[model samples]
Target: MLFKLLLLGLVIWGVYHFFIKQKPIEHKDKEADVMVECDKCGTYVSNKEAIIKDGKYYCSKKCAGVEQ
Candidate 1:
């Protein structure tokens, strides 16, 4: 018909702009991990999973006494 409905609306807008309107680019490979509080229970954690002792920063290793 009208050139097969303009080639089926340009193949449904090129399959909705190459597969359903594209929107998936979350690549964050490291840049939001520096929390670290827990000096024995103030408890914040995530300086790459806390626990460094003496200079403080524990979120476990049983609050950094380090028995396990």
Candidate 2:
């Protein structure tokens, strides 16, 4: 009985490992994530998260001197 249970478990595991297809992870683009230097304080940050004003890059809106 124990041998049969082990064999059953092994068969299930093999089927799951061989038959399942994993989806590939998708990203927007590599260039969008490139590190950019902050113009105000020289801190490095990702291009997508940086604030842009007057053709300059800033780590935050505070550094860019833009206020709400």
Candidate 3:
């Protein structure tokens, strides 16, 4: 009876340890993106987030002297 109880307790402990533990997460590094800087504000931004005009980069229209 004690052996059976020990086996059941071990099964429950194994299930809890495997399912209720925090898992390790992994993410790929995005190195294909280019980094850019704002001319007026001196702020850094990704190329995808910056505005391009006349071969120059800017963070926003207001900083580029294009905003009303």
lDDT of 2 by residue, 13-65 (tens): 98886655332223335434889999989999999899999999999999999
Local distance difference test, candidate 2: 0.85
lDDT for model 3 comes to 0.78
Off by over 4 Å in 1: 1-25, 29-31, 34-42, 52-62
lDDT of each: 0.80, 0.85, 0.78
Higher TM-score: candidate 1 or 2?
2
Best by TM-score: 2
Clashing pairs in 1: none
RMSD of each: 7.6, 8.5, 9.4
lDDT of 3 by residue, 27-52 (tens): 22344457889987888878898888
The per-residue C-alpha lDDT of model 3 at residue 19 equals: 65
TM-score of each: 0.27, 0.53, 0.47
Which is better, 2 or 3, measured by TM-score? 2
Query: Residue 3 in candidate 1 has what lDDT?
Result: 100
Residue 6, candidate 2: how far off, in angstroms? 56
* Top lDDT prediction, candidate number: 2
